[model samples]
Target: MKRIGMLTQIFIGFVLAIILGVIFGPSIAVVQPLGDLFLRLIKFIVVPLVLASLITGITSLNNVNKLLSLGGKTIVYFLATTFFAVLIGLAAGFILSPGKGVDIALPTESAEKAEAPGITETLLNFIPVNPFESLTNGNILQIIFIAIAIGIAITTVGEKAKPLADFFEALAQVMYKITGFIMKLAPIGIFGILAPIVGNYGLDILLPLLKVILAVAIGCLLQVLVTYSIAVRTLGKMSPLAFIKGIAPAGIVAFTTASSSGTLPVTIKNTQENLAVSKEVSSFVLPLGSTINMDGSAIYQGVAAVFIAQFFGVDLSMGQIVTIAFMAVVVSIGAAGVPGAGLIMLTMVLQSVNLPLEGIALIAAIDRILDMFRTSTNVIGDASAAVVVQHQENKASLAKSA
Candidate 1:
């Protein structure tokens, strides 16, 4: 017999979990270790996966100056869109109130809510004085800073630094392989995790999950239909209908695979042939967008962070809200363009503001569902950047001739 697809397996597990929860009620908590074990496995990989992948990702860019000169328009467009995407997610979270009706126990430490840090204090904490201390503490933002600093230095030092860059690049591959291994256990983990949530809270808990799903789905649609549509029509001089039609093939691939990197060939092909982007423009912008542009993931993070906060009854202050948007954008720089990468990135968003990690399990069971929508949005966003950049370059060339 053929193997079951990962999403199918996960859906099966999700259904079974709810059934078990309803059947056994609170008694089903005995299987909780399955969830804990899965979480620990994910936690084991997070630090190394992020550190190595981030370092390699930055190192691969090699010359930051070269990127700015060649892909500057694409980069700025991506950054602006990503920032707006997060705000949209925040709005969806607050307005839709996805996590409002749920009541779950939070960790004792998390239960004692700390004062929200000021903007200055938040910035100061990102610069790990002792990098090792940050690693030991799992200070994600600091770790990202260290990775960026080291990666840039490696690039600046030139050929002599090849060995260090190679090491990290290889380590990143290893971590990715390990993460793939762990993800296979997701069905069991979801079963363990969700069963208890349903058992205690009853089926009403599933309503929030549905709302979470709706919020993210709506965000994805808005990003594509509203954000990218306007971007292509205004700056790219391409109609929204044309942009949507042209990018549909790649977007479908990205949605099914939930991996931006995996969908690049289709994206490049569609951007060039369908969208009329020059090969040079499509080649540079789409690939870079794949690595760093994550408007959809940003939206998901914003919604998930707010949902976690609400679920835990943790009141989010303005500073905390800003922190979520900032962290989502920053972490997007290093997030892997693979399936389920959002789950790991979500941890960073949660850690930024001291939200409970256990809340991850609450969302984990349905992550693949959200991943589909976000990955599709990400691919389309990348293609849209190519369209816009090609237009800007064309205008500049015409100006120079004149």
Candidate 2:
């Protein structure tokens, strides 16, 4: 019965959203507020979730070096995966020719003329001058780095911080519970969000870019199913098929929710229940993944950058391609958990090559439609990591048993 209820709600939400969006067009504006509300609710919880979860996850670990090792491995894997994703995007955008011969006019927005941050400032600002303001402004990397520091401090204080440690542990549990409760409304929120999205653009939006979207989706799926599968099967030594199965719920939820952080709770739940990962690992890794490991979004940004470049009749040289790859990696790190995030990241990429910012307005029309695909891929990547983590622990357990 629980299974039935889950399936029913999800299916209904998706079907209804598409139907309503197609029929009403932008007149679905009434429901647009729900999308904003839903995103706000998710944003409201992110800071607390990171602080509590990181503190608890960190304090629980006896070996601080293991945390560093995990961080290093995760970042290395994320970078490799993102680099490949960017390559796939650039290659496909170049090969399939997504932006060729279009009569689309660019939208005029005042902000388009403004300069985006340079590589150095963007890097420096990541550390944050004021941590509190970073949180207030929704700077995810800053918030994450701060949580890591707080967590390490809690660990270092040891017994002296027992009471505080206990308090944060409880706080983590509370946040997880709140996240669980809020997730129940995801179906309704998804419906409300999609109703207007479909209404505003309709299927016609995909007309020009369907092939490109498909190419991008293929690249995303390859990253999740192929690249991640190898990581789980070889490095983590899990059954790749089982890993994919475990992540299905989270992937589907991501597809529907389209917010990695918003889907974090679902990813955690799915990792534990379906993937059989330990709570400790899931608690530690999933939140961080939500912030920094956006393999799917990275893929979209790479593809979209090249697509925009081509669409605007901008012929990028080999050096420019390398530049795009470099910029994509850096911008992707800063893009964590921002709503409609890929568009912003793509804007940064376009500006790097001196491409017209007007190109962004063209992509904006179809961004929501393409976003659904990439978000699913993002959640899949999260689940794959959880599965790999579990696989490593299981191997350790087996060794101990032997």
Candidate 3:
């Protein structure tokens, strides 16, 4: 019955948002408040949910070594999956040649150069100098580091911090309840977002960059279907079909919202409730994955690099491909946490290789469309990781018991 209510409300919200968007047109500003409010509510919960979940997830572990070992496996899977995604994107972009064009004058826009942080600086930044400041500013990576630190601290204190640990355990459950409550409004938010989206831009907006958009979507599908499924089968040793079925809800939310962080709640709910990943694993991995493991965005970066290069008729050397590969991995870390932020990161990528920023306008029109698909792929990747992580953890526990 509760499930029915959630589904029903989602549908109504979706339908009404579209109707009002079409009817209100420019006046979407009125209902826009509701959508903004919804987004704010989700944003409000992200930090607390991540912190609480991580604290609980890590401290609950009796063996700090197990936590570290699991972390290694999780990261290995993340890097492996993202590397495959990049390859798929590069291949698709090369084949489609979406940048082949007759004529479209580049826009006169100065590219915002990304402040390229050194490898040392990037590594140093992860160790939070001040944890509260990281939380206040919503520096996701820093917050994660802090949470894990606190988790380690709690575990070190052991029996002495049991009460404190229990509090966080309860807090994690409470946060999940809050997430479920907000998700009830998802359909309405989806409709409202789409209505203003479609009303303002119309179908004509898509016609210009349709080819590039389609190519990106195809690349995203390839990553989700090929890379993820293989990871689940060989590494996790799960049936690929079951894994896809498990992560579908997360993919849907991601596709509609285009925000990986925003989709975290749905990802958590689906991973734990529907897919049966342990709360311990889902709680730890999903939040970390949301901020870092962006297979879909990495793919987009690769494909976008090729497309921009093609548009400018600038031949990319093998060295440039290697540079793009390195940059794709780095840019994805920054891109996932920012909503509607992928394009800005893309601009940085093009400028790194001296591609014309003006070509960005060619893809900007279709950015939102591609974002939906990329985001879906991102969440799917996260959910798949959670399932594999949990299955392995369970298998280990059973073996020890035996």
Candidate 4:
């Protein structure tokens, strides 16, 4: 038999895992340790990867103006795509009305509140008290901040920084190799991670809120397929099909793992190798995008907020819908790049529109299932943004040369 591609292997493994999960039930959970090991391995290398790649990319630029310009463009693209995602989510919720006929029992107590840090607090936290501490905590945003600062400082130091810059460049290369090694285990890891989830929940949990789940899934697909495609085609001036094909590996990993950070290594590698985006752009944009470019979560928040309101038979005013959109954009920025971080941010969105906090309990059961889709969407958005920004930078460079 001809060899199957890695993507096909992962997809097959995923489908079989679900089948076995439905048949074997939670007994399939025995292999969960393999998944946990995969997650741990990814997490183990992320900090160093981000640290080395960002610093090396930034220092290599050797031009503060270019760095700032790229940063501005990246942030603008992220915000714009995120806003579009929110609008898509709102449309999905309004059209699908996922919560209209559902009657789920509210929990006795509210879901454990994972209060998102205030905007001001989040900004302040970016400046780490000790950079080493941030590394230890695996604080991605903070690490990016510190990495850029170090890179800027290196640029100012001129020739004196060559050794340090080369050292980090080498480190980044090493991490990429290590990432490849870890990714070899992806099919097994995906099986291990997904089997238990499908086994535990089965179709039973899905029946009650199937509409809501479908709405979220549809919204995510629209964002990735429609919204990001437009950006890639028009803005990035690249083939949408090519862009999707290039990022497929990262997207698959993101789907299986349901983590932006967990899939970062794969994302960076694919962006650089497959998409041919410069390391400078991929390193800076992908990491920043992972932290803040949560188009998928924003879409989910819009859908969930509206679903919750509809479930409770509450008619939201135009003002409340607008508030949900605004809050979704803002809260998603502070959302951590981990599994289920969006749930906490969803609480804030619920409160913005005077929706009941208890509504979260209704969706909590299947959040993981939905998370897998949204997380994949988020990674795609990040990769798309990187491609767009890289195109813009190349155009600018060509114009300057002319």
Pick by lDDT: which candidate is best? 4
Ranking by lDDT: 4, 3, 1, 2
Cα-based lDDT for every prediction = 0.77, 0.74, 0.78, 0.90
Error of 3 at 338 (Å): 1.6
Q: State the lDDT of candidate 3 residue by residue for 87-144, as single tens digits.
A: 8888888898878882665545534444545556767888888888989987777888
> Candidate 4 — which pairs collide?
none
Each candidate's number of clashing pairs is 0, 2, 2, 0
Give the Cα error of residue 51 in candidate 1, in Å. 23
Query: Model 1 off-target regions past 4 Å?
Result: 1-68, 103-208
Clashing residue pairs in candidate 1, if any? none
**Tens-digit per-residue lDDT, 60-86, candidate 1:** 666777445545687799999998899
Number of the candidate with higher lDDT, 1 or 4: 4
**Top-scoring candidate (TM-score):** 4
Point out where model 2 deviates above 4 Å. Answer: 1-8, 32-37, 108-114, 135-138, 239-241, 393-402
lDDT of 3: 0.78
Q: Work out the TM-score per prediction.
A: 0.61, 0.88, 0.90, 0.98
Model 2 root mean square deviation, Cα atoms: 2.8
CA displacement after TM-score superposition, residue 370 of candidate 3 (Å): 2.6
Off by over 4 Å in 3: 1-30, 109-118, 237-241, 334-336
